[model samples]
Target: MAAELYPSSLTTSIPNDPAVTPSSKKSIIQEPDQETEPAPTSTQPNANSSTETGSRWQASHPTLRERNALMFNNEHMADVHFMVGSPGETQRVPAHKYVLAVGSSVFGAMFYGDLAEEQCEIQIPDVEPAAFLTLLKYLYSDQIELEADTVLATLYAAKKYLVLALAKACVAFLETGLEAQNACVLLSQSRLFQEPELSQRCWEVIDAQAELALRSEGFSQIDPPTLETILRRETLNAREAVVFRAVVRWAEAECRRRGLPVSTANRRAVLGKALYLVRIPTMTLQEFADGAAQSDVLTLEETHDVFLWFTAAVKPALEFPAVPRTGLTPLRCHRFQSSAYRSNQWRYRGRCDSIQFAVDRRIFIAGLGLYGSSGGKAEYSVKIELKSQGTTLAQNRTKFLSDGSSSTFSVWFEHPVQVEQDIFYTASAVLDGSELSYFGQEGMTEVQCGKVTFQFQCSSDSTNGTGVQGGQIPELVFYG
Candidate 1:
């Protein structure tokens, strides 16, 4: 019989040799087939490997900022072009298709989904040309110096393009930079963009300056839902009577806008759900009688309830729940130690405070405080250890110099320890450097350490078995 032929796409089959075994022949074919597969096959498995070696390699891999910086700075021959701006006036920005696709899901879907974008050119008409350029810089460099004037617009553009990291950056900027002048406007913008954290921050700001916020024109424009949320808060620095009066002003403005009657019932109707949130019980009888009770905004039944509660005639119709634990104090996230501390020998620094990390992060020194002109400049040898149950789990050591010009300094670590979730650990430092220059009063900072405690102070005498000298604590910062 004649041998059968094979198609070009398929490999040619070899005839069984008279001297060869089937099993050995199978092994030879398998090895060649692996080599024939695409180059991506090897890398794909490595990307998802569970081994520690693989994890370390993945963690150390270059970030988007690093890759983008190298590509744009060195001009790696961009493959895509964006024709951005108004009609008849536009700018062409060069970018790599791979970078854009990786940075944004929107870009990824547009480039490679069911409707693939063509290779030639693309236009972004909605995003401001300048802002879009800035977004590209952030997308590539992993950093942008955001300013108040353009941050909101930049955020809008980022959200439009589905660049979550950039959007988050913009939100963070707005959060820290929010001021009385812009709080109301930011509140409105936050609602429009569905940024709950920013909105909550605005509310917290309002609580601090409720009277001032009430006087702002945007106060009247606050949507009814937000109004209720603010009114329901117990910690509104202003008295209940003050907020009740503001409620009346807001309601009156709302009524006049609709050309409705300015009567109390009509005002109450306009106030809607917000009226119930006011804690009428907290108001003094004199204030309620002269203010809230007389206002057209509070209903007769609600006013009666207020009057009865103040007189102890009856319990309030509804109890006021505590101001849903107002905004977190700034100190909640970080500890501040203004005093100076000195150390002559290596020992655990101070009391260990329990640290509960909401997210797994690697913590590093935020600043190394050094005293005199000569104090901060010297390179200090230091090592930090994280101990769990008296065993050292992780450690990082390096030579660091404090910024000579400034009291606060930052240093790069040679080996930053990886922290995991729900692990109880304490941090200790070992130092062998020049005697640190300190203030008149020695300050002892605390850390979250394991269950080991030692009675030691700032003494260099380690000649005895029990004596340990205290060490200076470098203010630590955490990163994920």
Candidate 2:
């Protein structure tokens, strides 16, 4: 019985017209033929039906109309869904006709610009409708999703479309990604694309990762054209130039360190080619030696030349400036005078000795005599002494009696001499204790001639006389 009822229910058919038989109308009401009729793609009528259960169904069986209405509503709903989630933009674009939203359509237009003329459809990835719409927003307003990873490629495509905003977004992404550790590929692409900002960012990253740059074999990996571009960049200073030179030099050093046959034909040729291409600073050993001898400081380029030259000529020369002189004489005072002191039974008054002394002063004293017997032969000896007060400081005695009895004596104080003030060469000597006297051709500093005991006769005979010619004792004179 169950199998028979299932067949009957499965074959149930709704009447096409309400004027049909009663059983046909009842079948349309209860056991409708869902299998025979085309199902509505919008919704199925069952437990969740809104178009079911009512006396309004008997008047007209509105299945086809209802289905058409549901389909139209669904299409409308689809339009609304896209408006909220995946909506795109279109315009009666200007003469340029470029003001279109980004997405598959824009990319398709771009891809079409350079594509072969005749094509049916383009095979592209199934981009999310939402993402495609987001891209369209970007094209229309230059707004982008910050967290969207595919935005970079989308920008690239947009850039191809000559969209200025999309190009800028691409540049920003490349530069930001270039800052990361494993962003060499991205940076390389940026450089290839001739993006100035991205290239600068990549160079900054290279400068920051010096060790990584050194280890990467990137020096050799970079072609001559690329290196030329980098080297020609005027932004590099002396320090950065040194780093650049080091990178190129490392390739040669690495070859040697690895025990590679650097002298081989191919290797030598390659090296020569590199030398020409690199335009690294070059100096002969002689030129380097001359530079070192002449200059204390050199720029990085000059230093590179010197290093290269030394590698060839193999000289061990140190580079530095010469040290300059550094030695110290004792001060000598030949003539010195202190404040005057008093001694002896008699008092002596004087001011400070106002004699200006010179290092080349000549002070000499002549012979000093005592009596007629000429005590200077014994006690009348011409004894000159330098004294501080009554204390004898230095004394020298020189006998001035000539063998021919022609007395002539003099003693010069060659260095310096001092004398007391107010009592200089006075008619009478000031005696602190004894007067200093000069004897003829002797060392006497002063003379006291009032003590003469021998009377001088005005006779030329050999007797004691005050005769300037024949009769002579010892005439004394002073020179100050």
The top-ranked prediction according to lDDT is: 1
- Candidate 1, residues 273-333, lDDT tens digits: the string is 7876766666678987998777766557766766776677546765433233342221111
Compared with the true structure, all predictions reach lDDT values of 0.51, 0.32
Candidate 2, overall lDDT? 0.32
What clash pairs does model 1 have? 264-296, 426-449
Model 1, C-alpha of 375: deviation from truth (Å) = 46
The C-alpha local distance difference test score for the whole of candidate 1 amounts to 0.51
Q: Which predicted model would earn the best TM-score?
A: 1
| Candidate 2: tens digits of C-alpha lDDT, residues 169-264 | 646644433322323333444554557777665554444343344344434334334444444433332133343344345444434544565443
All candidates: TM-score: 0.42, 0.28
